[model samples]
Every structure is written in C-alpha cells, then in structure tokens.
Target: MCGIAGYIDYTGKAGDTELKKMTDALSYRGPDASGQEVFSLNNATLGLGHRRLSIIDLSPLGKQPMFTPDRSLSIIFNGEIYNYREIREELSAKGHAFISGSDTEVILHAYQQWGDECVKKFTGMFAFAIFDEEKQELFLSRDRAGVKPLYYYQHNGCFLFASELKAFFTYPGFEKAIDPQAFRLYVQYTFVPAPYTIFKHTWKLEPGCSMRVDLKSGNIAQQRYWDVLDYYGQPKQKIGDAEAKEALRQRLIKACEYRMVSDVPVGMFLSGGYDSSLVTALLQSGRSEKIKTFTIGFTDAKYNEAQHAAKVAAHLGTDHHELYCSFDDAKAIIPELPECYDEPFADSSAIPTMLVSRFARKQVTVALSADGGDELFAGYERHAALLGIAAKKDKIPAALRPLAATVLRNTPKTVLNKIFSGNTSADNLAKYLDFLQGKTDLADMIDFANQTAAPDTLAGLFTQAASPGVLFRKNEIRKLPGRLDQLLAFDYLSYLPGDILTKVDRATMHISLEGREPLLDHSLIEWIATLPDEMKYRNGVSKYLLRQIVHDYLPREIMERPKMGFSIPLVNWFRSDLRPLFDEHLSEKSLAAHGLLDHKQVAKLLHEYYSGDNYRFTLLWTLLMFQLWYKKWMQ
Candidate 1:
C-alpha cells in the first residue's frame, strides 16, 4: 500500500534530488510518510524512495527503505504480504530478528534468507524492490496475480523501476518517446499489454516474474518465477462436486480472511454480483464486527445495481454505503483520466471505480476487491457463449464453414446489419467469419470478446500494425484440453492483467486506497485451474460452483442475476455530454500533429459516430483517451 521508485544510475549523476522528485510524483499513493535514500556505488549511484500509506504498521518504524538486521539488504515495498506473520515466525525460528511489525521488514529478511526465491514463499499482492548491498544488484518482483503494478525502464546501462509510470516522468534525462507498436496494440486492445508500455524501453514487469539488474555489468535478467500455465497444464482434478464445493468454500474463506490483515479499517467493494456477494458472505459470516461495504450506483436504472447490493447488505446485516452518481460526477472525472492512469488507457468504467475508491477512502484505508473471480472461475457470459460458439463451429462441416463465411463476408454491411438487428459491426462480422474459417485463435476470440474495435477497423485507423505482444502466446494455450480452459488461461495472462487488474490498481492508487484482490489469492486460482472445466461452467451456467457456494449464504433470488458490469453510459454520453471532449481531442489539428493515426480514417469514424452510430463509442473512446494521454505526456 505505497509507492516505490529507484534506479541504478551507471553514469553517477542522479541522486537524492532526482529520487525525491520521482517519489513526489506518487505522493498521493503514500501521503502518510515519505523517505529517500541514495547510495554511492563503484561507478554508479543507486537510490530508493518510498511514499507510505501505513496500512499494516501505522507507526514510523514501518517506514520503508527498511533494511535487514545487518543492513546488508535494503528494500522499498508497494503492497501487503498477507502472510507476513507466518513468514515472520518462520524467519524468527531461523534466527532472524525483526524490529518493526511491517511486512516490508519480513520481505527484506526473507530475501536475505532465500535470495531471489523469496517470492515463491509469499502469498499476497506485492511489487517490490530489494537492493542487495553486497551483490550490488536490485531484485524486483510482482505478485503472481498482477494485483500490484511495477514498471521499469532500462537502456544504456541505467535501470529505473517504480510502482507507477508517473514516477518515470521525474527522472533526469529520461526519454518520453512513444512506441508505435504499443500504440497500435492500445488501439486494438484498449490498453497496452504488459512487457510493453506506451513508451519505448519501458515495460510493466509481467506478473509472476522476478528481475535482477547487475550494477557493475549493467546486465538485466528476468525470469518467470510463477505462471498460471503450471496449474492449467495439470490434468483435470477427478474430484466429485460435493468435495470440490467444500474445498472451494474453505479456500474462499481463507483468501477473504487473509486480506483482512491490516491495522487500518477495511471494507469490501460490494457490487452485489456473484463475486463480491460471495466475498461479503464469507467474510461477514463469523465476524462480530460489521464489514463496511461500498457501492457506486448510476442514476440510470439499466446500469444501477445499488438496489441489489442493498438487499445483500440488508440480508447480511453489514454496514453499507452507496452513492448515486449523476452524469456530472462521471463526466467530471474524464479530464483527469490521463493523469490517473498515466498511460493511454481506455477503460471507461475507471470513472465509477475511482468514484467508489474516493467514497470508500473516507472510512477505510484497505478495501478488498473481487476482481479475479471471473477469470479464475468462468464468470463472464462470454466464456459460456464462446464455448457455445466453439461447439457450433465444431458441428458445422469444416468444408461448408469456409463457404458460409465467404457468403457472409460477401454480404453488404447494411444487409448484414439488418439481419443482425443492427447489433453487428463489420469488425464483429470479420472476427466471427474468421472463427468459422478456422482462422481465429483463442487470443483473437478474446480480442473479439473484449475489443473496442475490429481488426479491420483498427488496421484502417492506425499507421502501423498492432504488435501481437502477449496475444500470440498460443503454444501453451493450444495444449489446454478444453476451449473454456484456453479462454480462461488467455484471459488470466492478457485481459486480467492488462485491463482488469490495471484498472483496479490505477483507480485505487490514484485515490491513495489499498485495493486488495482477495479472490485472486494465487492459491485459489491455482486450485480452480485444476478442477474440471464443468465444475466452473456447466449446463449453461457460468461460475456454477461459485454460484452454489454463494447460494448457501444468500437466497437464490438475491444472488442470481444478469451480470451488470461496472460501466458508464458511454453510448449516450459520447453523443451528448462527452461530445465536446471527443471533438477537442480528435480534432484535425491534434491528429495531424500526432501523425500516428490516419486523419481521414478518424474523420470517417467520427462522422459515423456523430450521425447516430452508437456502436462506435468504444473505438471513439479509445481514440479520445489516447489523444488525451498523448497531449498530456507526449506533447
């Protein structure tokens, strides 16, 4: 629950002044305290800076740049190691003495005892940097589920790492060149995928990864310390449904309780969906203290779930808070999106996410968010629909599939739209055709499911081809025994981290709140990955097992409902309230100045969107977001 910034400056230039500036950029992430330390090396200078929110240890003793007993290893941490007490006991038995009741101390000592292997023994959300004084190297690790963010820039013998990309803006002589490949992917995926930032030479450390940078040789080596594939690759567990349900219940209970490890008051972001309801039910079942629950309701009824959440809160008898946000509340947050994310992010739901975080921050410092449930347990409707699509694709004769796709492809857009009731776009049709023609892969299907634009549309819009950053990692996915497993695996790697986790981390940290993903406790997902696919999605029910467990605590009517995701009315707003922003950001002057997008193509899209085309809202928002970010950070 903090912000950390550090660098190995081989040129011996940057020191306390630069480090302080870097840390200052993230001051909101840790408003409670701040610290900066610089160490002179053989021919370089290494510095570590921290902004602390004081979640676990509220005392000054928990201040970071914390060191081991011998001071051989210094560390700056950005998340909670939920199992710190257990690890502390283990370390104490191994003759380690701790001076503070902070997970930061436990991490430093753990690294001292286990070297790079320390990440394997921990269970929590974390992105940390440990400066090994003796080795003259920096060891960096991100949590397995990617709940916390860690970004780094490396080139020309200097290595810079931080908890957020904003910190890099303060470093001396740091280049701000954009990566065109990443931009095209951003246009295609609506968020830059990991290992690739919006900037050249900068990258988000992949989840389940640890990197070591050697000061003397300036050699950087990164290794995957953990991966979902390890679990997905295993044979499906043959356990019965009864045993599986009980096992899952026990795991869910443990995961939710573990996230309650905090000195500060904690709450739940209860959306009243299956995921959040289950977390609330499990955590509030035995607790004497009522858990504070927060929900953001839209004034628009179609998007509002506050009433459902209120029912759950009433049923559970927990303290609940709800805010009904108008268009003004959401629209006011748009101008700040570029700064909040610090990247060209296009998740419009971020507005409400930020609102909830701000509302909850008044009463709690730590809030448990149920984010990984969909990816881990087949909760999304698309998961079931895509499996259906695959089944239908399998049933159609492979030879006739190509003919069918050809006939559909040859049809005029207007006729196709008429046939599909104006709900299908050319991009959607292209992807569906690819699937029928056997040209679509798992990643492409995922892109179709989550895309803001179609492949053909993006190709026409961008000057460069989108890079298949992580989407092309199909060898392992192809080996999965079921389409559902493949879809889940690809999502865990791409969408979960690239969009979902990124959205939560940035939105929460922007408001200085520690958002914990209890459902994403790596162990829970690992176990879920082992169970048969049917256990998760069966008989047209998504999250079958999860629904069963939730039903035990909540009545069927209260918990079973269509998943209304955290969303804004972008369709109407883009035409009315947000039209000015779209015009301002996508003006000809702005597009011509950037020279990365086709002005004519953008104009065509804009014209269609303004002329009663609501489906283009996703792509339009993507463009507007990129333009906003480009003007802020690049220009």
Candidate 2:
C-alpha cells in the first residue's frame, strides 16, 4: 500500500517543490520512503509523487515514481496486485525485462503488453496513474471494487489527481468552496456518493473505470473496463448446494491465501461475525504460526462483539488482541473525523473502525478485512426486507392498505419501537407496514429502506436554492431479475464503494496500515452472483451459505444470532457524554456561521431529540458531522 499524487499542468507551473508538498500530505498513508518526478512534455509539464509503505519488496528497488527501462513511461501506484507474481512470469515470457522485484514493474510491463486494457488483467485493489512521455498523455485507473481511493480535480486547463482529497489543497490555485448539490447529498445520505465530492471542483474516479487525459488538447475521456452489473446479468450457472458450498470453500481459501502473500507480517480483524470468523479460520489453517487477530470492544454490551471475537480467536488458536473503548475514546475520535474522512461521512461505525485500525497497526503492517461479504452474498437484513415487502405487501387489501398506512403512521414511534423491540422481520408488523406505506414498486421500497431523512424532510432543512441531494438517479443501474439481486447490485454499485469500502479504506489508511479484503476477489464475487437469492437468503436467514461454511468451523449456537451490525450508542452518547460536543460543533451559532443549513431547522431537530424523539439521533449525527466538517474545511 502507498499514496500517489500527480498533476498535468498545461502552462508548465508544476515542479518538484509543489509535488513534494502534495506527496508529504499523505505521509500517514506511507512513511518509509518518498519520490517525485517532474517532466516537461512540449507545452505541458507532468509531475508524479509517491509515498511508499514497502509491503512487497522492502528494497530501494521497490521505490515508486518508477520508470520503464527505456524511460518512455513512468508510474506511481497505490495497492497490492495479489497476482503480480503470476503476471510477472507471463511478462517475462513475453521478453519484458525488469530490474526490480516489485509489482510496480509487473504493472508497467502489463501496460506495455496490453495497452489501456492492462487494468482488466489485474486482480487486486489499486488506483494508479501512468505518465506516457512519448504520447504526453496521463492514464488513470481504479480497481474493480474501488477498495482504493482516487480523486481528481480539473478546471482552467489544469488536472490534478491524488490518493486523498487533502493533497489537492496543496495545488497552487485551488479553492475550498463546497458543492451545494454534494452537500445536499451528504445531508440526505450522510455520505456524498462517487463522482461527487464535497467540492464542486473535484470528483472521485468511478471504480472499474479508467480515464485518459490528452495534454495536447486538455481533453479527457473515461471508459469502464469492468462492472458488477455485467456479471450479475449473466445467465445463472447450474450448481448444486453441496457442490456450490464446497466450491466456495476452496475458492475462498485460495483467495485468503493469495491476500496473505506479503513481505510484511499480516493479520486479520476478527469481528466474530460470519465473514471475519471464516477469514480467520482459513488464514490460521494455512499458516504454521498463529496469525494476529484484532478486535475493539465498547462499554455498551449491546454494541460490543469483542467477547464473541475472543471465542472465535481462541478456537482458531491465533494471537488475539482486544481493546475496550469508553465513551471518551469515541469522543476523542469525533474531532478527528472531519480531517480523517476528508469529507462529511456520517457512518457512526467509523469510530470503532479507526480505533481497531490504530490498535492493529501496533502489531502488523498489513491486515485483512472481511468487507464485501455482505454485498456479495446478500448478508444485510434489508435484502431480505426487500424480498419480504414484495411477498407480504400484496397480502394487505388494496382498499385497506391506505387505512393501515394511516394507522401505522399515526401511532407514536415509541410505541412502535416497543412492539418491534429492534427486530426487523415479519413480526415487526407496525414498522414493516409503516415502511410499506405509499410504496408502489421495488424502487419505492428501496428508497424507503435507504432514506436517512425523507426527501420532503431534507428539503425543508435546506434553502430553496439548494438542489435536493440526489442519492441515486433512475438510470444509475439496470434492473436485475430478482429483488434481492437488484438490491445487491445496487449496493455493490453505490453503497458498497461509496460507504462500506470507503469507510474501510479511510479507516485502515488513516493509521498507515494496509487493509486487504479477501472476499472481494472478483472471481469469487462472479461465482457467488450465479447463485439464486434463495441460496443466499431464505426463511428470514441472511448469508445462508456463509453460515454453513462458518458452521463447519464454529458452533451454530455461537455464529447464529440476530445480526448486531457494528454501531455506536448514538442516542445515549449524544444525550449524555457527548451533549457538550454537540453543543460545541452543532450549536446555532456554528450552524449560522456555516451558512449551508437553516439554523432554526437544525435547532428544531436537536430540540426534538432532547424532547424524546429518539429517531432523530441519526439525523442529528449527520447534521453534527456536516457542521464539524464545515468548521474544519470551510473555516
């Protein structure tokens, strides 16, 4: 893992001094060594900078901003190419000579052998930019799932790209104005989705995509090399339950083994969830020595899973470590979230994620994570909810459906919360019907399920001039066959990369530790995509096949339980220990100075939450994060 930053200056202002500042901004991502190269290409000059973490070849030969033997192409890359050794052999047979035992060399040769299509052959997380000296062109590509981050800004005939958004602030003529639509999106979704950053001048490069910039014309064009939708739409392959499960077991083992190939010591974050437990089991089984496992515990038992993680680690006979964080530990993290996420990210779980990363970095340089398992195998309860809504919503009489909706809407949320008791299935009739109210189709169901704030409610919080943060557009993804399949694809497209993957990338990168996701192997994702939703989820059970594989290693009693997702005690924390923090960052005075939100409306939400409107905790968190981010960046 490394950090990469570069720019294309048509007027020739980019130089080594400017590149050094931009690269050093990402030192937290890589602290071992740094390099920069600036080249004049006719009318334009190109600059590339890299901060090396040295996970693969711990030698000076592995230094980046590396060049081809003939010096025609230069490259700076961030991420591990797990299949680099295999590809290196192929490139060697093709008479591609290399001076370094680094994946950077393999990528350079592959680009020479495959041209712009080189990214198609890579099978790991990556975001890289290649500067072609002869063509005076810059080519950039991000991995298939966007596990690595890349952002760029283009305006006034200048183009700049970086591993983190902060690097762009080092550019000479950069501005820090917030994008209104993106701010609205952040308010609505608690996160601004891809291709949209907090700043109007910058954009995230979409995953599985590449862009080519022509220095001569200042023209840029983008192309998608791979997409999840293409694989989701393929005809389902025929396979039986036992065969499929066994195949998945072997494939996952191989994927885990591949991710374990690093010069540095590696470990896993054993969350004790189905995904993490399996990763730990497979990893320990393949290695002779015990692997390190990390977990974070919270004071609140309902939100803590460290005890379970301890059990999993003890059973697997691995080196286990756990850190129990107090309310103060989380509070200390809030002040840093603005600069850590580099954007307004409202995921409360990021607090624990960062704590865990900081803990693991003390022992290991590379840590394997179990993300993408949910998106790949229909693990979220919402997937089952989407299916249940279709099957159960029609059972309500059409004429009485409006009456039921009215009744459910009229009932106090406190009463509804009592009845559901936090369970989210058929037994939660009041909440289910409330969610189903006015829902016409699967799209409506999805929107209702995903809403952090109602479109109407969010519209009221902003001025009329602000465009509604469009969380998703109609044509963003093609319709899939099954409701679960469509939801999974939608998440893999938007929520997976935008929220989950982004959260992990930022959290792991924050502490300068490399995070690898074994389950995100594209081949495993494609094979799992061929299975029917029934195999993935059924009878109110989520990740059905995953449970079976984990059961082979763990007791069903330990692994099977209501999924307590990684979350914080938001309502209690805000009302008690964090009340002063809320006052400091989200006070009326702060909101007024920010000028993005209506001060009165923001105050009203806070007042209501204090008045026992418990559901407002989420919205309040979002508002607080935005205000905090504004204070950090806009101030």
- TM-scores, all candidates, are 0.97, 0.95
Error of 2 at 635 (Å): 1.1
Can you tell me which runs of candidate 2 are displaced by over 4 Å?
A: 397-440, 468-478
Candidate 1: tens digits of C-alpha lDDT, residues 500-596:
9999998898888999988899889889999998898888888889998999999998887778989988888778767788888788888987789
lDDT, candidate 2, at 67: 89
**Steric clashes per prediction:** 0, 0
Residues 1-635 of candidate 2: C-alpha lDDT, one tens digit per residue:
99999888876777888889999989989999999998877887789999999999999999988989889988999999999999999999989888888999899889989999889889899999998888878999999988999999998667899999899888895677788888888777778888899997899999889999998888899998987777777788788778888999999998999899999989899899999999999888856799999999987999999999999998889999999998878888988998888889999899999999999999999999999889888888777756766775668777788787777666776765564344332223433665567544565556555657666567778863665533444244436776776787778877888888889888988888999999999988888888877678878778888888999988877887667798778788788878887777777688778577787887888898888777677888998888887778777
Which 10-residue window in model 1 sums to the lowest lDDT? 465-474
Stretches of model 1 off by over 4 angstroms after superposition: 407-423, 464-472
What local lDDT score does residue 254 receive in model 2, on the 0 to 100 scale? Answer: 86
